[model samples]
Target: MFSFSDQNGFCGRRCVWVNGPVIVGAGPSGLAVSACLKEQGIPFVVIERSDCIASLWQKRTYDRLKLHLPKKFCQLPKLEFPEEYPEYPSKKQFIAYLENYAQKFDIKPQFNECVQSAKYDDACHLWRVITVSTNGSTQSETEYICQMLVVASGENAEGVVPEIDGLKDFTGEVIHAKDYKSGEKYAGKKVLVVGCGNSGMELSLDLSNHNAKPSMVVRSSVHVLPREIMGKSTFDLATMLMKWLPLWLVDNILLILTWFILGDTQKYGIKRPSLGPLTLKNHHGKTPVLDIGTLERIRSGDIDVVGGIKRFNHTSVELVNGETLDIDSVVLATGYSSNVPYWLQETEFFAKNGFPKTPFPNGWKGKCGLYASGFTRRGLAGASADAIKISQDIAKVWKKELNHKKQKVPSHRRCISTF
Candidate 1:
């Protein structure tokens, strides 16, 4: 129950009862859904915390970044990358595509409105999304009451920074991979890059190209696959093989191919997981790092692949292997996590990690008209799939209500999916 007399509580805030769903992100996933909904002739309000769409790409990513996968796998719905664009579009090209997509769909997100809390109001049977916006000294709060809610804020809303022993003791600069743009500033410095995911590998490669000596930390085992095999995308090849073979067989084929192409990566301190690449990805969401010139650099000794760090000294890191290396700076390519748990005030749909409790293929829909998009670890392709499903589900219910009710306005909770 909410208090009607309270000054700063539910009743006091400016409330807008939305005619349709409220999408909580403006990234590719959100834009995809927006386009799908547009096709369905259903209106939605996209609420974005950042001033611009795809803020992660525009603000956080490195300058040398390119789509690790082929452009065909990374595009949004209703539009494809330009024909002249390369197979793996650059960071700028991808961003341009997203911007064009949003414009084509007329997806105008409410920029800078940070969602503080979103909860299902039992009394009214609607989702109450409370948001706060600030401009100069003035701050305003708005409560958006909608029939359906779409959580498209994505999995990488916040960067992860691990706490290292004696990290503060280091006198040199420390930065997360999100802040890293280029290696131009580290031309001659010895930099230690933590984590061996795509960002870590790319950062190390970039640093090496700029004449910086970089030691990349491989704390644990990770599967690394060549971006392409025999002029075909490694991922595309895997997908095709999976159609005709069992997962284990597909994994073996991939391993055999990778061996022939890149050799045994364990020799360079990078170990493969016990499960196959696709198997690991399906079960545990562990994505294999798709090599993009980083492996050659590693082979050439331009980038040093190292073991985990034991601790940080004033100007060096003590490795778990008992080796010590002096470094001028530290770049933590520690990855990112979802920010849903911070705002969404519900328990059943979203897990504590801010992902749907149900795994992908079934994670999109939840009780009380909650839906998730782009939470799938499968990247843009998964997001596009989710967007289509969500739009179809919502549109079906909405149209049914309109047809049945005739004169009555399609009431709240009408878009609830039977699934």
Candidate 2:
């Protein structure tokens, strides 16, 4: 069912025709969908901009990074983590699991193919995906034509680097959290860590552990919850409670427990948001920080917590509170956003921010056989659910159409690639 594209002429442009779908990512979301479609006896070709699978995990993540949530909730569909893996698998462990998943499912993505544009042809009734790839000094382009197109590039495809006043003037090491690997290089130096999300918190902790002084910026209010409650995971507890109790009640209970365990985080320059953690996340997509030893480090005076930045000097940072501190490096953990809007031509299904106009549980499907897999802010569990739904829905339609087409079903789909 999978073969090289026909050598026929299309003005010398390479083209690939897919009978099933062209999945536009090789990350967990796309992998999950591909695995499910394979189970349904569907054919698909994954296209990844990066060469390796899960490039974020393999290349961008820090050395000490581990899953913020437990492994059970993070696993993809049709496969479970190995029993030997810890509750929170490290970055390497997670990457290993993804590799094994890809191997098991036989999901071979066309790596290094970055989609330039994807648009639907109204008259032809097919999705056209134009991709550009570079190999050494040589570059190539490919166009894929398919009935169904699965947009699985995900939310964190690109990093967000904010415009900071005097950032260009600062004469010190500046890096985004994506390129940061370890604090080994910053040992015995003062480092300014921007953003207070999970990455910022964990990165600051790692800096302190490596003997580097880290001052994290907490500009706005954030909900910092204990990673565990007594012996149970806070995430697990909340999920369990939400099944039977209301979300508000569950939020309140978790907050109370967090206060009891972590004490008044506000006293340490950290402010909790007005809305409850779950409510804020649901409404505004602001995820509460799950404290993983960062609070303890802060309390112990190991990791300093600072306020917003007014500007940066040659060797000092001016804070909104009129305070200033000298630092040797800066790590902007400003987070990431989706690149869907940049390449996706349609506007109705996806908003200007690149997320679906419809939210999770309903955002997976769209008109003209278009689908999205990981726009869900709910993480792996939500994505896994979407993957199953997308596969099943596509299967139903594909089967019906095939039955109607009868003997006209083509055995080979075209693909365009030239060495």
Candidate 3:
């Protein structure tokens, strides 16, 4: 039990007994935390905003999308993907795996319940969570109190739409990458894909396969590398290279190596921009189309690479070089922004980009128990790192609470006494 005193008197103090912790978001990070907590026999409730687990994977990913990392490295801890699955699981297979994981652990999250806000109550030393759920005709808001809060909401919650001038006025359909699932919807349409990221590249390929006649809008030069370099996974190769060299040196070396392996993309109207991997700052490192059968399609004049969209009208899109393209729809794969709205307004503990500040010392010491995971840039291995760190911290806090409870026993009541 914990109590916080008010200025009125001892009678004004509010006491809250520890029940269990609350985990917000049911993504990979949240599921990992829930598994760890369940293993420890710690009571917890996981809240998800969607109707199903791994909804983002099912809803937001485009067709032909595959895991950037190998299957061996991308799976949750203690759960191995079956050998029947491919080297890189597809969106549908990944979602099925998550379903199996949840079912195996008996982790049934309360879905369709979205968290609106959470605030710490000093008087009770607990976090009060407010959630909204739709109930047929009317909506209802429910509240829950917990001793701690774990925010596992991923960084890509809010889709980013590039602020293009006069975009709204264009009559053609405009869609973000989140709304794009398959190229089937774009059959026989003239599609202009904006951005040169993985989503843009893969979506263009899928569209071309569906006879959509898609054109890619390249803003700047992009570095294209094969998904596997020298018969190994790209991630594995990058890890090995980075281990022995500085980041800059490693990036330069990889760039040179890729250029030698894959001829200059300039012949296809694509230029090599970065020397290394595509990063937040350097968005130019394009993954090699992985020879996933897309190369032959490109060589057949199915996919056309064009300059960036300088401006657009109802029926025509003008390129940066004054070239014009008449398209039926625009698919913007501009990426996502890191925004956690619920707690950002009330807490000063967050990054400039709105992610929660990590390595919370006081919260750890006092057992206040607020922590963030999966916001760091460890690529596909980020979720794993977050799980390890969060589990260690939770264990420390749980031990401290148990010790405090044991200390409350009277000396005479001890079963075994030490003289």
Candidate 4:
């Protein structure tokens, strides 16, 4: 019901003063925070660039994609997936859940209004959220001022397709995983999927299942763990252990378990680094792929595993090990960049690589009414927890300010009567 009407104008401009926080992006993080704000009776506004909620999951993701982690670990605060749903739901089911969540909280985000820039005003002690909208031949700009600003755009804001030598020289089609839908068109064709991350592994498996001769380009060392261990979801067990055990102990125990479960990956041409999975994750913020089928595909000889790409030829790719294979298409699953620096260029909110220098799980909230959400290394659950914590913190500040104002009201009235 929020609008940019004449009555809502402020500072002689097309502005609306939001009493609560202004959250950018209507994804999981933003919705979680919105739910908390509603519970606290705080008026807030969420501006989203996409046309619908959870567009990242609803639009960009492929049809074959599913939740890598169990639904129990991925649920937001006070919102759990139905018991009828699977432990790991498909992309469509997950999107439906998010839509239901937004509806349940009556959270309506302003869609199709992309945030162009944001700045904190020192004199006013507020944030200015600038947005632009285009309708046919007309374009208009709008500004929003709020005391608290939450940037919940999430980490995968931009797709990253790594540049390689002679990429243009290839005659076949080239696309990023962001554009990949289904593997139907790739059936019977040799496709090279670059990167061994979750997307890469999953996409390669999808292609293989669709009758495509898929090969995964394992660029560097990666930890690939089985999705299930001894009849239980590895994620479920990990969560249970993480709550009680220290990180180091849990990490080492999982490493030993993986070794016993999957044996030596190097023997099958899968080389892992010397460090453990959790160590690599903590140091580099890399999520290890929980394999549901990719490992089995590799063992069954349905999918081939190759080294990193050296370069692309006419219809072939040369690997770092000097191996060349004729490929019909190439899918870059290299992953995504945070793209924070592009929007927050003036602020020290992010590093040069578009990732937060002091990322979440420690220092997501900074001074000057600036806050970050959904940038945690622990994925969805961590992002949800961060949103709830941030909303509570903002509520505490508002409470203190209201109490101070209440204390001043009685004194101000007595002084006026004396005058």
Candidate 5:
């Protein structure tokens, strides 16, 4: 898939020198890191595969998608959302904010450049990044050399759909949430929503609002919560509570509150896991859906909540609870893969699940000048903090290297070079 442009054909290799770090992806994570580097007056080249930045928010998300967390928590390092923005901004608003952030920071990423491979050269004490650029039928290759490589492709780089039995044979229509834009196209159709994550719940609600019959296939246990309780944002409350109380105590309080508000999920056949929603999120990084109106819709029977999918037939899908229903289309909100294993050469750097092995800010540091960011599952705030720390680490290395280089040069040469 890698190609280089040449006078003769498309296999030429050209070296592009980057005096500082080489960052991958121009999403929030990449831009956050770039901003931090810019603050320190560091020179880095951000390589984005897509034509524009923040492609996830720009392209993958549905038309109705909005930030689950408040705008304050979601803002990048130094930049803040407009005062006129709502508590939660829509997908487009967030993308526009990122665009503004990039422009404000003067982060001009090299667009349409897909990273082919990155390898560390211990002999040269540098990292090699090979990128391929494609324009129609033409392809160009550029090899970049830098002391550091930042992988900010984010956690959800690739969509992951579970391998359901007989899925490929189903004839109606199949699509992942990544490709789903709006429910207008699916109005009046019987849709089966797979996975009960935030995307799934929100998508189900969107379909219901558009007059589509959505039957959600809950494959496993999940946590659901109202977007607010007692006029306070649940996320905002949880963040504050975690700062003061122990996790176990916080879990119990949240459970009690959820019971008082939403009552028993089992009444509607939604299996609530033993672990508290916040506890589960902190431990496994799986977030509960911040129910806006999805719960009310589900409770009112506007949407049908079903058990795990057993299998699929041509015209219908069977549930594990021995119920079968005709489905006109299937929309998978099954989330995404970490995408770290595909690029990094060092297998030890990844976890058992194919995600990067490191955690939070530490995970930003990797083997052989390679660092992974935006995969912490901490959302925007976490990514921003991690990016800042990683940039600080890089700055330290850059300073030491500069000092070493200065020491290596003869006094007369150093004095002359200063001019």
Candidate 6:
């Protein structure tokens, strides 16, 4: 139990209380974790920054976006999307599904609540979660002390705006992929899309379809594979191969398979770089941007593929190779950067880029009780993977605590087997 005190000088009163695990961000990953905990009869509180769960899908995604992977493999365990839904759910349908999932599980998360800071109390062995809720003209602060903390904040929240020279002087409207919604706004306008990721490619196509005359600016080579290969979804084939082959070998095979299915990308002035470690991390495995017949649109002069932006004047953008083009707007399909805003500058739990360095032990490290999911591109299955891993990790810690209380055993001796 905790007490609340009101100070006349402060804006609002604070509520202090002890609770179960505190899960932040109500995307698919957060909702899935909450569902799992519910099944285990574990009490938990889910905090979301938006008014509804999966708001990214509902708000940020483009008009024509659909899940790249098939529904059978992309859904959460023991949960099935509606039979009426297509094999590849559209962004609208996906958001509805998430809402349905929450209702089915009776997961009434505290919406409009944005987490400001989460800090661990060494003395109490509990996590203190501070949040701000804005509704109408009123704003309130709340705090929760929980035994565990799960960060389900998906990687898409913070848009990764690249450092481009002379961008600020361009005088044109510039927005990141997270701010893009529909192509209708850009209709009859010339739009430059940076990056060849799914957002870049899909948004370009969407804009073209809406008569926007969009151009894609590619800096690095991209591997554009067909949605299906050999009568099977490319995701299924990749999953099968990854199970048996090393990453390098798997990439080679995937590239070879893609070549036969989608043809080489080099013909369109786009080169496929050497397959290195896939940098685009999502829980779905790998971010697969389906060609979606956009190549034909590019060939027909409906969409232009340009190199990276070097500098931009008020009305024109110069490419790295010195090529210049005038554009009405610039949509940075640039991707996103991870952030742990609550941590202090001197905190050893975070990397220079603000991501936890631990969970990815070999290439990741961070403090215990703090975890991030949906950062690694596992693909359309990423949300499920994040949920599974976080749930398992929390269960392990919870079991250890329970055992210590019931059997007088050391936490180390009572550790739950992750395997």
Best by lDDT: 2
Which regions in candidate 5 have their CA more than 4 angstroms from the true location? 1-10
Ranking by lDDT: 2, 1, 5, 4, 6, 3
CA error at residue 137 for candidate 1, angstroms: 3.9
What digit string (tens of lDDT, one per residue) describes model 4 on residues 1-419? Answer: 24464464443346778878899989998998888888897778999988899888887899988888889889987789989999889888888889899999899998888888888888998888888765467666678888888889888988997789988999999999989999999999999998889999999999999999999988788888989889888878877888999878888888789989888778767888777777778787888889877888898989998987888899999988998899999999989887667666345766677556685576568777777888877888888888888888889988888789778788868688687
Kindly report which residue stretches of model 4 are placed more than 4 angstroms away from their true locations once superposed.
1-13, 243-246, 406-419
Quantify all predictions' global Cα lDDT against the true fold: 0.91, 0.92, 0.71, 0.84, 0.86, 0.75
Q: Relative to the unseen true structure, what is the C-alpha lDDT of residue 171 in candidate 3, on a scale of 0 to 100?
A: 91
Candidate 1 lDDT trough over 10 residues, lowest sum: 1-10
* Count of backbone clashes, every candidate in sequence: 0, 5, 2, 0, 1, 22
Query: Over the stretch 1-419, how does candidate 2's per-residue lDDT look in tens digits?
Result: 23344487544457778888999999999999999999888998899999999887888889999998999999999999999999999888999999999999999999999999999999999999988886678677788989999999988999999999999999999999999999999899999999999999999999999999999999999999999998899999998999999989998999999989999999999999989999999888889999889999999999999999999999999999999999999999999999999999999999999999997669999999999998889888888988999999999998999777755645443122121
Whichever of 1 and 2 has more TM-score, that candidate is 2
**Model 2: how far residue 193 lies from native, Å:** 0.3
Q: Tens digit of lDDT per residue, candidate 3, span 336-370?
A: 76556644334555656646544422221123667
The digit string of per-residue lDDT tens for model 5 on 105-143 reads 999998988887888888998888888898679887888
| CA deviation > 4 Å runs, candidate 2 | 1-12, 407-419
- Candidate 6 C-alpha error for residue 120, in Å: 0.9
TM-score of each: 0.94, 0.95, 0.85, 0.92, 0.95, 0.87
| lDDT at position 375, candidate 1 | 95
- For candidate 3, the lDDT comes to 0.71
Better of 3 and 4 by lDDT: 4
Point out the worst 10-residue segment of candidate 5 by lDDT.
1-10
